[model samples]
Target chain A: MITLPDTASPLYEKVKDYILANIGTGRWGKDRKLPSENELVASLGVSRMTVHRALRELTSAGFLIRLQGVGTFIAPPRPQSTLIEINNIAAEIVERGNRHRSEVLVLETIMPTKELALSFEFPKRVSIYHSVVVNFENDLPVQLEERFVNPSLIPDYDKQDFSKTATYDYLMQKTPVTEVEHIISAIPADAETARHLGIDVGACCLFLHRRTWTGAVVATISKLTYAGSRYSLGSRYSPSKSS
Target chain B: MITLPDTASPLYEKVKDYILANIGTGRWGKDRKLPSENELVASLGVSRMTVHRALRELTSAGFLIRLQGVGTFIAPPRPQSTLIEINNIAAEIVERGNRHRSEVLVLETIMPTKELALSFEFPKRVSIYHSVVVNFENDLPVQLEERFVNPSLIPDYDKQDFSKTATYDYLMQKTPVTEVEHIISAIPADAETARHLGIDVGACCLFLHRRTWTGAVVATISKLTYAGSRYSLGSRYSPSKSS
Candidate 1:
């Protein structure tokens, strides 16, 4: 059994942490069902409600699963999302049990060249806004976000304090989105990208390009990349209809 | 430029496939933006509607992201999900341009042992249903699913033909779910699991243990293991109201 936390901490969080730690350490093997809820209540010397709360939260968070007539079991371990908050990247990292911060690399509006014009579907004379930001988790550079904003859609893009608020949150609030798109890929870190992410050149990094829309007008686009060693990808599947 | 299909196939699907192939083949580097719908329409001799359809699907599937005033850019690539489906696992393989099949290793109802009884919060006199199944992709064993069903919750589970339908789908249709939990981990494959997944014993395999529920009553529990090489995990994140 894993050690529990002091009594001062929330009993449920303590239980959740204990179970998660044990699972990470492999004290419980794969496919091994766990003790009952009543048993957990007794062993942890916590109230039934407290034990249930911990179990419930863990279940929702994808750490433990319970069956109706069957018992609960430890779930397989997965990657920890450095950013899991409802907010954008800055808030996401802070919620990951790490200190979150950022620095503005480039913040400007510029004209698109011929290739850029063709890419943006804009006339050759039209301008597009571009921003590059480096996000840090616990003082360690982890992600490079290269952003291109539609000037026509977000005219006041420079008014917001991106450090305090994420572009994702701002755009989401300002625009009622009717569509969202993402593209994910893997590539070796290039010199510039590697430097921004604090990863050695040639190391693998995962990239996510995201675009959001309000009705038919495009709202914003961003290229976010993370160091491969620092992250893993994960998703869940249910046979039922998805939300 | 992605090669457009000859219009013999689903136009949108073919276009998506062409774009995906280019991304997979490294034609677009990290942060590299893609051509616009107009360019694709003019160059491929396809209608803008067709190009938009393809781009729209790829964007939804996380292949490309678009900015309103800016052009569309290639999204970062993430890991691919090979076996995280709640639908029939066999179907997923076939859809991936590969062959899939399964072999049942064990299917029986047995009296609950002490450990099993304690896990399910059931009396030792009750019985528990168990099954072991191995699934293959392209004739290579890729997954081992060891599951335990609550006899009380799923009384006729043994009569179901799992070879045609997954237990998850069956349960979801028969008993509507009110709650479900998922756990993911990495563990060394046991001899049996290793043999099923065609990996050496002690090699790392991704594992998932899931439990389903209808209201407060427990439904079923399943422990599944997969060969990590063939199965990668992925998920998407959007700044939602909860964040």
Candidate 2:
């Protein structure tokens, strides 16, 4: 049993809110069958049309699933990656109610190649901090992150233990990032990345090339790869009122 | 010789602007090598470090490619899909200075299945308009668009000539879309999609599922597939001042 919010919103919206509250409170778990339209209409004292609209909209919003000839069920939880935000992998996983862990594979200070120097806008042979970390969601490897940091921005980048604290988390605590750019592509994983992610060689992966700036100086550049089979990246858009 | 913009921007930004202007004005075509660091320093009256920073940032931005032991060269144009906007395929191609065309493969009325009825919130047995259009960029098939439309929203949906006016364009003119949601994923293409896109079967494809709403009614549901080898989607983000 649920109580609808008393407001000026339409009847369908109230029904939607009530249904969402039940889901949010964990009264209905993932893949649990939801009440049919007739049951909802009877419980909420609304018309069948109103209840149908509520369920349909929730399905469209990825919160519910409706199978033909079968009752509607709660959709399985999806790990949603925000398209417009430079999100830390650990934060994203934890936000989805999953435990996040990391394994540090490579961390060292190395001399930049000519191409790397050009990428960092630093002089040739300058030392930069490089690290490779594999992020896991409840023991399943999800992301392989390879990052290069300018030594000038974070002098002690190599001293931190990334398995305990994510690199992005550490950087955010030290300085304010002014801007971030992302280049996204789908690529076949090479042998190394495939091995780390536990996917077969040549499996497709979502590749994200990201660069962050701290007041016009490049602070970090990273190439992050996610297993395409288990992960998806998405965003939503609503036209402004003026438009 | 190109004249630089006289502004208060940093010297490196000004140099970057000059190089961009040359590329924009067709002075440096795709894959064309630009003047070396020493040559640019001598001509622009700027230090070597300034020129290095400008070129390095441009490469990071995907505007240039730097090769070791070789001069910098302009990168080939890439088709970038906006992550936040519900962009029309024709418009996206034309915006990239490329020719756009479409081949309509399937266009007819379909009886709504139970799943389709649930998706549209309509009763089963209702007829809906369905279409499949293959979008091309300079004759190369790039996307296979499969769509289902609520016939009540647009009465004459099947009569429109999609080659002359895109289905998305027509829908926009007929109704005011209130909200748009997107779900993005990566999957291997089916045999039919691969044959249509001229790619090998089992090749990875970028899959986009989009649904647009008119008020509370679902106006359209679309599944757009793009060749992963040729396309990538991206968006930019900047932290708000309040954040």
Candidate 3:
């Protein structure tokens, strides 16, 4: 059994921390079998109920996996995103018990580029709203989001301060999207995108280009780039309609 | 009006090629308004029905977008994969009018690693089936696939010649997956993966880790890496359950 410490925090939290510390220091590596509840209770001088609560909490938190009759083991570190669902970054960070913050980089109106005009199906001369925001997970930049908004759909898009509230939240409130398209790719980051993402140029980035429509009118278009080393998108489904 | 040549193919095919050539050369760039059907018929010296058929075919093939009441315009090149669906690579290539081939790289029995043992919830001494294959689209290497199978689930996994058949197809025949999970990321290609993909080491690649389960047992786990420049995954959906 691993020797553990006692802290002022709750007994369950202390047990959880001891387990995390061992795992973090590689004393117990990934997939390493965890000491059973009886062993933990005996070694740490904790109640069996406390030990069970700690293990259950850890399992739900995704740090541990408990198998019936087999025992407990360290769960691999895998953060996942549903590929089909559009998620708000701030909420995701908070769900992981991490601090979330947004830094507003660029927020202005601009003329549409040829590609933008084509995606939005608007004339080239039409002006659009554009903004750049970098979302931080515990102070580490994880996502750099560049967005284009149809001015006719949301006329006041340029007036909001994104640092206070996320753009996705604001957009959802203004116009509920009826249809959306997501395009995912792995791409090498350009210099400007790298600067905003705090990643090196030419580094691999998971890229998602999204377009949303309200009824028949285009609402918003966005380019979301995430640091390759930090993020993953995932989904679990039954093979009923798809396989 | 753009000048174009007549080809030995059908008249509609000639018209389609004429439009494609102009778009390819950036002569009629993205979002560039196209001449009316009357103008196309007059310029290409083809019947109105022929021009209409050409435009309709291109629209259905995702090469052009014909907006009702607004005429047709050059559409951006975008290939997509539905994230929730497990697609057959051969069928996908054939759907795009391309040839599909597979090169078998490795097929053998291997002892499970500690991680694999934990994932499979088996002892370290247990043996598993493993294979590596590279899939090609029209002679262009696009995907490098590595798979591990639970031996108890598929006893003859090693005996099949993958070059003659796809593993997914074979697995579906033997065991239809009841549930599946997909985890996606962007990562720099390693030397071996780059070699198989015909790309430079450290180039960005799209990586997908997929695991399929039959009832309570894990059937297969795969690591699929694609050349970053060659592939994208996309889906268009109503914002019903997701936003």
Candidate 4:
């Protein structure tokens, strides 16, 4: 891609746009390496600083990754997932060969509030089991899961030791899940959650709110908050063969 | 909602969990103000520092948001949206009474690479119209959209000015979309993308990768990346109603 004309635009911007144009035009194919800084400066007729800034900027954006002493290369486009898959945090960490643990904070039955009654489609007077569990990966708190379960569905709920097993697994065995909803949000963690998650009091958390249905019974409603730095959500995309 | 004794644990953590329990169980309903710090200290029989820490942490975790002069209140639940409801960025910005513009970097019909061909479900030798557009919201770049369109479906695609009208709208009128697979990911913007989006070189980006099918012909493939600090992806969930 030709870059750095004697135009009014900044030299680096021109060079950066040129690189992007070539990449889009298949001039620099995916996973293919890019030219060195010196080569770029010479070819684009820009200063080393300009080329460096562009390359450095691109590397940070995930377009190109630069290894120390190694050449820079175009990153492979990520595959996006289609399924609305929401896995349990404890299960996910354990499956990744990491030690996972949880500290059970609260486990008791409470009367459903107006909102809960409406969301769960249950009578407002009914009692439900509420549990607050702070899950950790290798002793570092990653997710704070606060859940309310339909006590009627999970009989003898208070007898279960949740520190050893997730309510998700326990309820799955007790009743069949018919539906689920997953929600994600980013917001500042209050002082209490900051202490639990071991982050600054005002730092943000990525909150995942989930509600599961079991046949005619609403299984559980949970708000799982994760430290923004601790985890990332990923999905893959594949174009269909038929439109 | 009780704070049991566990002196060995961090005092703040113990207090915070107790408060979180009350909030989650609806003992502290949404928009309901919490007790003063002094009240909590007295009720929990904990040090002022411990109670303060707990409350401070809770406020940061999105469990509560503290207002100056006003007492702290429980946060409303996060909002959700329907699944993968694709909206045009330019149109959305315009609807908001903001000027929307785009710097068309590359717009050309080219033969897809082997992987690209497979992604678009076209013959290895087939050609596609590819475009790299930096869409601006009020002159501030917010989205970097890289897209591929099947030329066979829109043979005179070069005639359209995407800046004036989005490809999605144009395609929707020309072809009826039957199937779509959308993928979402949190990634760092590439150097080129960072420049276009006017964010830090390595800032996180929320990417929505989508593919649309229009009855046996793959319409297009798009990777829409948004600045994380400036944009968010949301969806709402409603319990399926049975007739």
Which one is best on TM-score? 3
The numbered model that scores best in lDDT is 3
Can you write out model 1's per-residue Cα lDDT over A1-243, one digit (the tens) per residue?
A: 335767786767788777766665567655667668888777777778777777766775566778889988875432211221112556556667888777778888887667656545555467777888888888888778888787777788776677767666666556555545654445567899988888777665656666665555566667878776675444333432211
- Model 4 C-alpha lDDT per residue in residues B11-106, reported as the tens digit of each score: 777777777778757787754888888788788887787786677666645567788787878876422211322356766678779988887888
Candidate 4 structure, TM-score to reference? 0.46
Rank the models by DockQ, top first. 3, 2, 4, 1
Ranking by TM-score: 3, 2, 4, 1
State the lDDT of candidate 4 residue by residue for A1-243, as single tens digits. 344557687766677667766665677665587888988877777788879877866664456778779888876542222333345566778878999999999999888789988878875578888888899999989889899888777788878999988876777667655566665555567898988899887565666677777776688888888876776554332232210
- Stretches of candidate 3 off by over 4 Å are A1-86, A239-243, B1-86, B123-125, B241-243
Q: Global lDDT for candidate 1?
A: 0.66
List each model's interface RMSD.
9.9, 7.2, 6.6, 7.3
TM-score for all models, in order of appearance: 0.44, 0.61, 0.63, 0.46
**Docking band of candidate 1:** incorrect
1 against 3, candidate with superior TM-score: 3
lDDT of 4 at A231: 68
lDDT of 3: 0.81
Stretches of model 2 off by over 4 angstroms after superposition = A1-87, A121-125, A241-243, B1-87, B121-125, B241-243
Residue A185 of model 4 has an lDDT of 50
Off-target runs (Cα >4 Å) in candidate 1 are A1-99, A104-148, A156-161, A182-209, A222-243, B1-100, B104-151, B155-161, B182-211, B217-243
**Candidate ranking (lDDT, best to worst):** 3, 2, 4, 1
- Could you tell me the C-alpha RMSD of candidate 1 in Å? 20.8
| Interface RMSD, Å, model 3 | 6.6
Top of the candidates by DockQ: 3
After the best TM-score superposition of candidate 3, give how far the Cα of residue A74 lies from its true spot, in angstroms: 43
